[model samples]
Target chain A: MRATIIHKPGDIRIEDVPEPKILRPTDAIIRTAATCVCGSDLWDYRGINPVDEPHPMGHEYVGVVEEVGGEVTSVKPGQFVVGSFATSDNTCPNCRNGYQSSCVHREFMSTCQAEYIRVPTADGTLVATPDQPADDLIPSLLTLSDVMGTGWYAAVAAEVQPGSTVVVVGDGAVGLSGVIAAKELGAERVIAMSRHASRQKLATEFGATDIVTERGDEGIARVKELTGGIGADSVLECVGTQESMLQALRSTRPGGNVGFVGVPHGVAIDGQELFFSHVGLRGGPAPVRRFLPDLIDRVLDGRIDPGKVFDLTLPLDEVAEGYRAMDERRAIKALLRP
Target chain B: MRATIIHKPGDIRIEDVPEPKILRPTDAIIRTAATCVCGSDLWDYRGINPVDEPHPMGHEYVGVVEEVGGEVTSVKPGQFVVGSFATSDNTCPNCRNGYQSSCVHREFMSTCQAEYIRVPTADGTLVATPDQPADDLIPSLLTLSDVMGTGWYAAVAAEVQPGSTVVVVGDGAVGLSGVIAAKELGAERVIAMSRHASRQKLATEFGATDIVTERGDEGIARVKELTGGIGADSVLECVGTQESMLQALRSTRPGGNVGFVGVPHGVAIDGQELFFSHVGLRGGPAPVRRFLPDLIDRVLDGRIDPGKVFDLTLPLDEVAEGYRAMDERRAIKALLRP
Candidate 1:
């Protein structure tokens, strides 16, 4: 099987790897139909996150089950399924409470970029559709595994209400998707911060009532201006940088919420500022599995077409090029068909 | 008029000061019947927070209205009243939404230690008793002005559930009162972190089910051990420090909440750790004015006696000793009868 592997910074390659097999009683082997390069992958590719060894590259995917272990009851052979970036035994107390990402026994699904991937905790991790999804639904459904679910979690954590003025702080696929989530959750106004023309268009299409082309303080100023100088009622911080975090904090009203979905990279929050502002901060690695079922339904019903985020697509053999495209900002997200 | 002034670190003086008079159309001069030294006041007295000048102190009080400004309507002369540390015009949008501490026109009652103090925003800041209370109710009514209301806000922000386990991260007067609030809010178990024997005793009396003598990581471990390694459902952090913040985060379940009421000093939060923990953090300078009325009712009905926190008493002229008792840890809190 061909899989994407990173040997080091700037050294992404698609190489022949051994085929995956069910190694656990709760495992399911899926023949990957689609996978994609994630925004986080660029971190390793750009040398921001050092790759100590050749490691599996992607975590988001939609696939058809080729085989299932005896303990896997929810998904079976020939079924189309979507799984979260983190695998969890949904029976755990944490998972039962919808914090599956923090499940006591959790596994990362980074090997999904390969032609065949083994998914553990299959019964609790994988959600099967009523039937095989159409080819057009594949990309959208693939997004439910990570990006869309994460965006939804950000919105939920931010407590976006019907009249909430929401500000999304990142313009990546997840941030763009948050615009949709905030709107879907009934936010009265959605503001997307993006300087990219292509990303701005999608943000507008996804229900962003306003778009702030500025970054940092200027972006916060625009948000405050849009909110009548009171700042946003809810802010979804999708970029985990010091500047982004500070902007999110500065742009939120006192007693408002900042729901962060971005994987923080050395960002530190001043407790005094958080305390004095009275802003409620809640978020971590998103429990994407909690929202997978709902997101899949939305995708199937055509309520959202998150697949549009994949501005470039290629065969699994071109995974290196896909990584390069996203790494260089030439593409918003890249889809790889296996 | 007599007032308590912090002349230097660990030095307090009870000295003569000008009697306060109505300074604005919205101000009222209150002849304080009772005032108390707070845990936060010691921050400056201990030099943890520097006091560059010999400033008048104390922010918690219950009093008789001695004089009223032309525009003061809700509270009139000779009326008994309990008001929050923060004086707010409750007509603002923030106040209407139950966040009076963040009200557009908010004022901190800085010199409540004085015999007569001018309270700004008097009409909306002070909540009068339905009738003049008997002498015995003064102690409990004084508690409603700050400590009790702050505790209730912490419990509310933490979202204590009917059968949840609650951990209070500080055992000061406010934290002990939080135990009362948690019980009132229906928490099944309350754990208080305290090393002082007197504070521990008071905590148990206030409804603490357990007491952890350790701080930070060890304290969190004790809480986890008590909760079957799952952590508490709600944690109230009444001491704002990096250690207390981390303890609050580490002691809460993945989906649990940490309600912090401590004024943050030099605390800084690691974004990645907070992101991965999945705990909800919310709190600020408490919206005490929002809870004062209901708490006053609870106090008046004899349902809760938070005045037990005040272990030491002094006349207004001896307020310097009140500050000394609290600063030296000889008293958890002290009351000054003016």
Candidate 2:
């Protein structure tokens, strides 16, 4: 099986790796239908996150179940399925609380950018489509595994509701997906902060009522100006940086919320600053498994077209080019066909 | 008029100060019916928060209206009222969002311990009682100005819902009030963390179902044990220190919330730590003004008696003794009568 592996910074390769087999009674082996390069992957490709040792890459996938352990009952062979980046035993306390990403028996999907991937806690992590999804729905369904699910979690965490004024920080695939989520959740006005003409265009098409191309202080000022000088009711922080986090916090009204979904690298929030801001904050790995059922329905229903984020696509053997394109900002996201 | 002044750390004195005059059309003068020393006041008395120079102390008071400014019409002279420590115009965007403490036109009541205090934004800040309460209700009504209202805000911020398992992480007056708040909010189990037996007794009387006397890691373990090893649904953080904040965070389950109100002095939260914990955090100076009407009704209806937190009482002139007693931990709180 061909798998995406990072040897070091700036070194991504497709290597011949052994096919994954069901290692646990609850595991299921899936032949990946589609996978993609994530903005988060740039962390290692750019050497922002240390590459201590060579490791498999990618955590997003839509696939067909090839094999299943005896204990796996919810999904079976030949079924088209979508699973979250994080695997979970849905019966755990955290999973029951709708935070499957924090499940006690959780394992992040790290080897999914391969021909075949082994999914643990299959019954809880994998959600089968009503039937085999059409090829056109594959990309949208694939996003439900992580990015789209994450965007929905961001909107929900920010408490977006009908008549809410929402601001989305960042213009990555997840941020663009957040624009759709905000609109789906009935946000009256969705503001997308992006400087990229292409990403801003996509954000607008995906339901952003306004776009602010500024960064830092100017960005905060712009959001405040649009929100009657107080700030939006909810701000979605899709980029995890000190500046982006601060911008999200400052761009929200005192009683509003900031739902941060980006994986924080070196961010440290000052306690007094947060206290005075009076903004509610909740961020972490998205509980994608919790939203899989509904999101899949939305995808199948054609209510949202998240697949548009994949502006570039390539054969799995060209995985290195995919990584390079995203790392260099040449592609919003690159879908890989196995 | 006489007022309590902090000359420096450990130097609290009663001094003759000029009487307050209407400085704005929105101001109203009040003859202090009762004022109390707060735990936050100890911040300056102990010098943790620097006392740059001699300054009037005290922000909690229930008083009788002495005179109103030209534009003040909500209350007239001779009416007894309870006002929040943080004054708000109650009409700004932040105030309309129920974050009155963050109002555009806001002022902290620093001269409340004096014989007479001037309250700014009287119409938006002061809530007149149905009638002059009996002598016994004075203490509880006075607490509505800050402590009780703060506790209610903590519970509200923590999202205490019916059947929620709550943890109150401070033994101060505000924390004790939080216990009451949690119960009132319909939490099935209320856990109060306090090592002092006197405070523990008060917590129980205020409706705490259990008490955890431990602190730090051990305290987290105890709370987890009580909550089936996943931690509480909501944790009210009333003591704002790095240790207390971390303990509160660790003691809440994933997807839980921490409502912090202790006015953090030197706390910095690592983004990665909070991200992994998956706990929602919202803190600030409590919007006491938002919860005033409801909390006052609770006091009047005899559903709550937050005044019990003031175990020590003294004449207004003995303000120094009141400060000393609280600073030395000889009293949970002290009430001053002018």
Candidate 3:
């Protein structure tokens, strides 16, 4: 099975790895149909997050279940399934409370940029599609596993609702997906923060009513100006940087909310500023699984097509090029076919 | 008129000051019946918050309207009233959305330690009781102006739902009041983290179901152990220290909420910890005015007595002693009568 691995920062390879086998009673083996590079992967690829040894990459995936352990009941062989980046025993108290990402028995599923993978807590982690998705629908279905579901969580955490005016910070795949999520969640006005023409075009098509190319104070000013100097009702932070976080917080009105989905890096927030701003901040590793059922339905019904975020695609053997495309910003996201 | 003044750290004196006059069309002069030394006041007295010049200090007050400018309508002369430490024009979008403390035209009402103090935004910041309260309720009504309202905001921010298990991270007047607020909000269990016996006693009296004398990690562990190793449904961060904030964040169950009202001092939170915690954090200068009407009703109707927090009382001339008592921990709060 060909899989993506990083030997070091800027060093990528595709090698034949052993096929996955069920290791837990709740495990399920899936033959990967599609997977993609993620923003977080850049953390390791850029050496910001040290890769001490050669390691497999990728966490998002949509696949066909090849086998399941005896304890796995919800999903079975031949089922087309989507699962979040993290695996969880859905019966845990945390899972029951819609925080499956933080489930007490959770196991983070990584290294699925491969031909096959083993998913633990299969019964609780995998959601089967009503039917096998058409080839055209696979890319969209793939996003439900992470990026799309994450965007939906961002909107939900930000409390986006009907008639809401929302601002999305970042123009990555997740940010673009958030535009769609906000629209699907009934936000009346979705503002996308972007400077790239391609990303802006996709953002507009995904339901962004406005775009602000400025960064930092200027970006915030642009948002406030557009919002009549009051700021947005809700702000989605899809990029986890100090500047992005502060911009998101400052972009929300005093009584509004900011939902951040980016994996924060070097972010330290002043409590006093947050307090005085009176903006409610809620985000983390999104409880992506919580919104899987609803989002999967939306994708299946053609109410949304978040797959448009993938601007490039390649075979599993070209995983290195896929990573390169996204790393160099040549592609919004690169989908890999196994 | 006499007022409390701090020229420097530990330098307190009762000074003869000019009588306050209505300074704004929306302002009113109030003959303060009760004022108290707040924990924040000690910040200036202790030299943490420098007092470069001799300045009168007091914000919390329950009094009778002595005079009103032309624009003052909701509150009139001779009306008994309780106003929050921060005065706000409640018509602002923030106020209309229930965040009066963050109102666009908000003003901090200082120097109420004197016999008469001018309150801005009188029509919005001040909430009159249903009727003049008897002597017994004065202390509780005074708290409505600050500490009590702040505690209630913490509980509300933590989203204290019916049957929630709540943990309060401070045992000061605000925290003790939070216990009462949590109970009032229908929490099944209220845990107060306090080292002092006296403060713990007050917390228990205020409806604390449990008390943990531990601090830092041990305290969080105790809270987790009490909740079967998962953590509480809500945690009120009543102290604005980094340790208290982290403890509060760690003590809440994933998907749980934390409402903090501590005037944060040197607090910087790690974005990754907050993100991974999957807990909601909200705090700051509380929207005290938003809760004033209901709080006043609660106090006047004799449903709750938050005023018991005041353990020492002094006349305006002995204001120095009031500061000393609280500074030395000899009193939970010191009430001043002018």
What interface RMSD, in Å and to 1 decimal, does model 1 have? 0.9
Please give, as one word, the docking class of candidate 3: high
lDDT of 1 by residue, A107-147 (tens): 88889888999999998889999889999889889888888
Clashing pairs in 2: none
For model 2, what is the alpha-carbon lDDT of residue B234? 99
Compared with the true structure, what per-residue lDDT tens digits does model 3 show for residues B200-226? 999999999999998888988899999
Candidate 2 residue-wise lDDT, A266-310, digit = tens: 999999999999999999999999999999989899999999999
Taken over the whole model, the C-alpha lDDT of each candidate is 0.89, 0.94, 0.91
CA-only RMSD, every prediction: 1.2, 0.8, 1.0
Sorted by lDDT (best first), the order is 2, 3, 1
Model 2 alpha-carbon drift over 4 Å, by segment: none
Docking class of 2: high
| TM-scores, all models, native as reference | 0.98, 0.99, 0.99
Clashes of each: 1, 0, 0
Off by over 4 Å in 1: none
